[model samples]
Target chain A: MSDNITKGKMIKPENLVYTKSRVMTDNVTSYCPGCGHGTAHRIIAEVIEEMDIQSEIIGVAPVGCSVLMYDFLDLDIQQAAHGRAPAVATAIKRLMPEKFVFTYQDDGDLAAIGTAETIHACNRGENIMIVFINNGIYGMTGGQMAPTTLEGMKSSTSPYGRDVATMGNPLKMTDIVATLPGTYYVTRQSVQKPANVRKTKKAIRKALEYQKLNRGTCFIEIVSNCPSGWKMTPVESNKWMEDTMFPYYPLGDFKVPEED
Target chain B: MERELRLMKGNEAIAEAAIRAGADGYFGYPITPQSEVLEYLTMEKPHERTGMIILQAESEVAAINMVYGGAACGKKVMTSSSSPGISLKQEGITYIAGAELPCLIVNVVRGGPGLGTIQPAQSDYFQATKGGGHGDYKLIVLAPASVQEMADFVELAFDLAFKYRNPAMILSDGAIGQMMEKVWLKPQKERSREFPEWATTGKTPDRERNIITSLNLDPNKQEDFNHKLQAKYREIEKNEVLYEEFQCDDAEYLFVAYGTSARVCQKAIELAREEGIKVGLLRPITLFPFPTVIISRLADQVKGILTVEMSAGQMVEDVRLAVNGKIPVEHWGRMGGIVPTPEEAVENLKSKIIGG
Candidate 1:
């Protein structure tokens, strides 16, 4: 852990540690208190702040709970239609090749309705990063079953638990995208804990660095939590995600560059 | 001081003119009758020449969303599609309108309620002039009847689109899109690096972060934004009504049409004059601004009005509404991709308006 990020009572000029990332605005987020979106949002801000490329970034926010991501991040953002963020990001990057462009999308937006867009944009090898969040259930739409929902997991639509025969199996999208030659880097991480949060931030930073190489697409899937949708407390959701979600979606790099 | 004349199809003319108009990007899916647009762009390699970004998107939906992405940055972006493809693009089109982004959308019309035919039809008049998407939004719809108009309206559409910060559509049909005519191509204009103040170029220390979004969850705020859009539309209707009158002076009958039907109606007017019938044609260039006032004024002088269309009488409703019973208004149309001939059109005008 960094020694500067301490909770101790050391209030000196050099010892001062706690302040919000300047990339994050003062506006209150609309996410549930225990939702991992806030952490994911904070990590994004921290990474952008630390990278010092705040002015060079252009983001496309997806149509989900994080649709208002632009409201929190102090960067130019375009809110996209459901599942079309990657296509939107594709245009932005193609037109402004010099700018750092990315798409912030959730499981429903990535693997379900926008499957064609996601695959084609990735296939095109657009020099952009896709910051994907996989939260098993559709949190914004009252815990409906999402494409990435774990088999046998109960949701509002899958009230009797997801039947693999009828509902299809959970899509390992990170693995699927990793197989694409267009992807330069593909990783699946989580933010259920502080350590995982750090790892995720590092992955995002690496994705941005790889983005500068102009090789291909960089995809980072954050297997996050939705406590309110999961009908669990934040702590319980973390344990459940570690137990159920991680087994199905392991946190690791699926694809890496030959050198990096 | 010589014009560079080229024999081009409407679809090709649009693609060439877009490059000459300094359009920044084009994202389109290849559909019938309009595939030539994407084909021409791909062949021309406009990116290598004019630095225009052209992409063959996976679907019409993705293409329109890509247009949204570019237009968000104040880029002169456009896409061309046929009827079914335009239906697929409605979702993205609504979002672009709701966000008040500027872009050009070209609908090279083919017949369809559902894959009806590959032939020319004006069935989408209701969809285009009226709200095609779910909102109180209207695209600045331009009816390009000729290859020359197809070439000219590319720059005109972008100008109006950027001026009003709204989407503009070039509503051409398969007849016009596939028909070949000589077009005087414009000189190449340089693409701009300067973006608009509201464009999402990037938030620097100099300005606040720019957001291009349609979502205003607050009902009160959404209502206020809707009012603002309506006001903008009203201003457009007041100032941007464009139409052409052919033989309307001292005429007793009016033929209201646009696009392919207008071309047919012009011939019908000549055919009627040969039969000692006094007829004129009022062709609406801007279908949304609609030439409503002129049609209403023309109603006072005309004995009756006939809206000649390729569809089963869609624009007739608007004509009847504009006339408001001051004069009889009737619709003569042929569905399933049938383009009514001049003789048949005059015959319908004679029976539907003069006799009925």
Candidate 2:
């Protein structure tokens, strides 16, 4: 039976394969099962290749699971300290305005520790892209509560569900960022289904395109999943994302500028 | 062609000089008297079709880091602030120095122990010459007296920064930054110097990955890094010592000063000369490679050397070290933004020269 499975074709539960390849390799990701980061990475890599701006692109990796993204992506990568990716990317884009620069940040890194850098970078109208991953919990640091964690979501730190009176409410970063005129593009997308993944790929592509055109600041928030931290299986996590997360954090573009 | 100069403030001169020097970018935060630098840049349309980038950063820390990023890519970048702001930029300054990136940093120094008065002071003399940041490093510190030198030294600072691939500083004071004079701006020249291919401007086919980092984990490798930096310092000291002398031919007393103090000392020397006392001034332009040999030679001919400054005797230490007790070296200064008048400096010089 094992021989039969090997002879024909066997798609493993943990393995993911994409059609188009850019600089990112086909190695199995270090993310846990049902992790949405792998999907987001694949979409960004595909968009980079599609735009054909790989050579002139620079990516800043923030501290978290994505800290070692330099190894995965074959672009000029700079590692920024926790929550400092926006500040670093601001410098890179300002210096080499012709280069397509972006940062991949986690919720804990952006909303919690690096709030000032993110807000100011957007306010300054830095012509760079930000791919913010909001997984509701700190996946790399043993599943701690994050700034974007839902009010009732329990984690290692908040073993008794996230009490808003004590831990504060979930931060709406996309809505906040949309208020800034410097922000040219702001959107929130998910990766629970293939249709949503396709839409997310388009959103990511649009942000990269805006950067290429040197329009202004572009931001995309990905409401990602962490099955390991959520204490659910891969299938159940996907179901939970649709049932629980979508209602609170509706997915769609929050701001799209009209050409004058 | 030599042109007549108009009077201008030192900070205003810096702004005009940066424009005339074809500086590609200016990232600065406003502080005290140095606000004129930012104000001038904002008023001037330097970035219109000239490819110049001017930004007012959120803080001094952000401004210097922005300069580091721009300089890393081979752009002519600069930033200016006062003492407190300069303190916030030490981390980024150390990184730029460690990477051997070329950039200019201007410090319009003010009194400071902790949020001290915004008045003029030379309290940052030790911080400027002796590495302001952590680790082993040195900035080419240029002290300018007149508004002309303030304008002239900006161009010179850029030259030295690019030549040595290190951060260069123009250390001035509030009197120089705020006082107005006439200045004739010179024509800007296109920089033709080529940077090493190792600068992180992205990879060409010929070179390996160019990493601009200060991290060294291994002890042996760190030692080698230190040795290389020392060699660079020695080369700089040999080639970059700059100073000016006034009426030292047959003088009995020598007045050692720099920056704003030098200007006051020059007036004092004239007054002393009228009083039948042969007094001369030796003003150092480059404070880091402190004009040691010149002071040593002057010590042989002079009876005593009086070091005058706006702060409590910082450069006097260097003067004593240079003279090495051969001649009695004395110092007098006013702290907390008070400029020592020519009368005060002349009186102090008279006491040191005659009373001794």
Candidate 3:
């Protein structure tokens, strides 16, 4: 930021091209290199800033890589036990309906251990947002086979590669949750490139905006990359995510409200 | 409306008491013996009357976590369950304790050791007192012997829960939960919106955002939190121990009991006194603080102490620990959901200590 300012004209507030959202804290994120959690956090923080709802929003973090989200995001956060964020968010939103509540969870937390909470909270039409990060494998716990682990995807637990016969097929959770009547908006997105990042931000803004209408749950599933877990470099992981992960967990809206 | 007297089941009284006490939320699942609590709350439509939030959760596990969330906002919230259901709730209870969030939990205990029976039992004494969940923590355990106490303790439990910033439990049994009695309900209290500065009530510019969690990654930091919690428990032990004494003056023998066992012991005391045995009863209302000091003083004055219970002598161990072998201490209990009559308890005491 200082270098760019030195080379450019004396910068006035109005002339600034970009700045980090104030809702984000100064603490450096602990997510691994090429991890999507950092980008997801930035997008949400930016959305909250743009909507000026930082003071009126409460977030729930799962017991995965993003467990320390409270340290990075300048918002009130309650950490939920593995796979229970949806249930926790449901109670928070139900009690404080005027406030916006959301749960940030990963694939293992949402699609596996938390499947019941996710399904029931959505099915009950809870007025909350679910930021589901599907990175194919569990990243924090040594890259184990998650419910969304693709077939032939090798992980620490799936040393022989995920055999669909034994390991089961990867769960397409957003599709299933979208089919539920309670969900107002369901989209699968990515942030692999600059264009994708902008689109994902728009999707997040739409999800948060829907909460004001008192609609049911707004679930946005981000098909993400886990560089360290996938045993690939940051650049290689992004390319792999675009080439492999996106093909299966296609990036697009599975459900949305009718045009008003 | 002014306070009214009505005949109600213990479970029903608890529900009404919570609403009248200005509870902000009630989250629970249906369980045997205690199902009437949720049923009564739902039937009363407190949502329309007092704007209280009532949610029937997916399971005992989900219900407890919901209570955790509501409590995180520093709202007066509670849940109730039976033995197995409470067992499922232990995980969330521990988390609540670790987070130092105040909430009330009611356990209408039934026989257990794997669905033992729905009949009343005191088998959860050790589980309740010694920290049922994983982690070094304690719940201010309150034992209610009658429907009135069951109703009254709901408010008292919430008071103590917030005062200590710890979880409180109404450790009743199926007998009390199902039995009916006339209770003079307390006047309704206004719903309080005041919360501590630490509550997560959406951050304002005046204060830093509050984070409600128990996760301390650093071992030393975690240890410090544990020590702080231990200090709070010690203070509770000093100030919150409560017990009721019946015919204890000029008595030669004492009976230590709680909950329904205490009620049964009251009758046994009468039976023994008629025979000029000089027996007395000491009923512990707060079980976690265990009434240890009073029990110690009574141990020095009595010839022998008999700890009666519905389960196989769970509270007796605490009595022995408190008695410290000052006098003879013995346990008399009927397991497998058997409620020993006054005559049976008296006979057991006679044969075990007085004569044999």
TM-score (all chains, Cα) for each model = 0.98, 0.81, 0.98
> All models: lDDT?
0.93, 0.84, 0.91
Q: DockQ for each of the predicted structures, in order? A: 0.87, 0.23, 0.71
Candidate 1 Cα lDDT to native:
0.93
Q: Per-residue lDDT tens digits of candidate 2, residues A193-223?
A: 9999999999988888888788888999999
Could you tell me which residue pairs clash in candidate 3? none
Candidate 2 docks with a DockQ of 0.23
Which is the leading candidate under DockQ? 1
Candidate 3 CAPRI grade: medium
Candidate 1 pairs with clashing backbones? none
In angstroms and one decimal each, the interface RMSD of every candidate reads 0.6, 2.8, 1.0
Query: What docking grade does candidate 2 earn?
Result: acceptable
Model 3: DockQ vs. true structure? 0.71
- Model 3, residue A112: distance off in Å is 1.5
When sorted by TM-score, best at the front, the candidate numbers are: 1, 3, 2
